[model samples]
Target: MTAVQGFVRQIDLPQIHDPRGDLTFVEGGKHIPFEIRRVYYLYNVPVDAERGGHAHRELEQVVFALSGSFRIKIDDGREKSEYWLRDPRKGLYINRLVWREMDSFSQGAVCMVLASHRYDEGDYYRNYDDFLAAIRVAAE
Candidate 1:
């Protein structure tokens, strides 16, 4: 996997193959860089629907496509990168202070997000301009 923005990278989870079915598991601080505190999944999304348009102040996340696929665009103040997630055993780890936008979801796509912190509206920089401004201040 390639690195992105010096903070984002692809994390490969441990997969067990069996005659019954394949199994994958994630252990916080082991499979990912941060401890997981919250878990959420998005499904039944329209093919043209878009999600995520913000950056977190202190929250880090690892997103996995449990089923189907989607595209995620990430930017770190300076550089931007995109990833197409389809495999259930791989995830995109995004650190705090990075902006992310998700779209181009395939039909029946399922996006699962493992967050390092609980949901906090105050922790979100929903506006791109404001996120960039915060990035500048953090860089100073």
Candidate 2:
């Protein structure tokens, strides 16, 4: 089992499979580790293009591939790791202050995101250099 860490987490949601069809769901403070405050999705991204080159100050999120597959690369100032969100029942939880970049999206991929906080532009560290400095200051 993949363990949750300060950097990232790979979690499996509850699913009920049947020969006819399947059912899946996610609930705040249940299947998800946080209380969901916002939700959004991303799609129609070019295969060569990447997304999410920033870190949040207090927000946390989980990214899931609802249609196809994609790779999420995350760094915690000192170490980096890559995780694949392939199954529809799976999600990658991004911890606060972790710099993230998503790439290698498959054709027709639809990425769904569940956020722990409401949209706040001031909470974002859009620059990699700024993200690095923020984590450094946070450690002390």
Candidate 3:
């Protein structure tokens, strides 16, 4: 096993602006670093409410704030950091074994997540304490 480090990767997306709104584009293995196997979005969220209280064992994800702004909290057990996602054309590339929580959403905030794997219960560590312990053990 290898040690985990928390980091954010930003991707520049192709955008087109019109009278209505701006359009951002993404294509698997092109604009996005990995082929997207699953797609999900979170909306109608309350302010200061946290979500995604889990870490994936092997899955890779790219998170984008499509509509509004939010804060992303990332932890590698040994260290933790927080990032604000406000740009629709940019995304945060989250690697494996890093715990993440999304919170501080503005009104009508839409968060889109592009995943590299299908849904699997076994791949997720839902408990924060368990995630910390696992990271500590992996670091030793």
Candidate 4:
């Protein structure tokens, strides 16, 4: 129930446990709040590597750590929070307009992202200052 203005939160997907191994599955618009249009993953990242220092205008995403772990810092202009993604069945859902910074990746960490839209450079606010200014303009 920890939600940042209903724009950021952790979602747990359904998991089936067995003696052999555990199984997890996600369905578009069922497990997540949006229909997944794009799926991508990051791997072989250095332990000191950093990723995702930007915000989206109209796109939302759910990021997961499939192999190891990583930390995500979220900012909504008014508040900031951090989350550690280490579980395969859990993901951090980031709504549109929320700034995000991810780092502190463990060795051999694999990050999977389920996006609501495909890659669009126009939808991204890659600069933190620009993103903050936009947030302020929208608030006023």
The numbered model that scores best in TM-score is: 1
lDDT of 2 at 38: 99
Q: Can you list the residue pairs that collide in candidate 1?
A: none
Clashes of each: 0, 0, 0, 0
Task: State how far residue 3 of model 3 sits from its true place (Å).
Answer: 12
Q: Candidate 1 at 100: error in angstroms?
A: 0.7
Residue 112 of model 2: what lDDT?
Answer: 98
Candidate 3 residue-wise lDDT at 74: 89
52, model 1: CA deviation in Å?
0.3
What tens digits encode model 3's per-residue C-alpha lDDT throughout 1-140? 12234445677889998999888889977876678999999999999788998998888888999889999998877678988999999898887888999999999999999998999999999998988887777778
Query: What TM-score, over all chains together, does every model reach?
Result: 0.94, 0.93, 0.86, 0.93
Which portions of model 2 miss their true places by more than 4 Å? 1-5
Better of 1 and 3 by lDDT: 1
lDDT per residue (tens digit) for residues 15-65 in model 4? 999999999999978889889999999999888888988999888899999
Off by over 4 Å in 4: 1-6
**Candidate 2 lDDT over residue span 1-140, tens digit each:** 22233458787989998999998999998887789999999999999899999899888898999998999988988898999888999998888888899999999999999998999999999999998888778878
Distance from true location, Cα of 71 in model 4, Å: 0.3
* Runs with alpha carbons beyond 4 Å of true place in candidate 1: 1-6
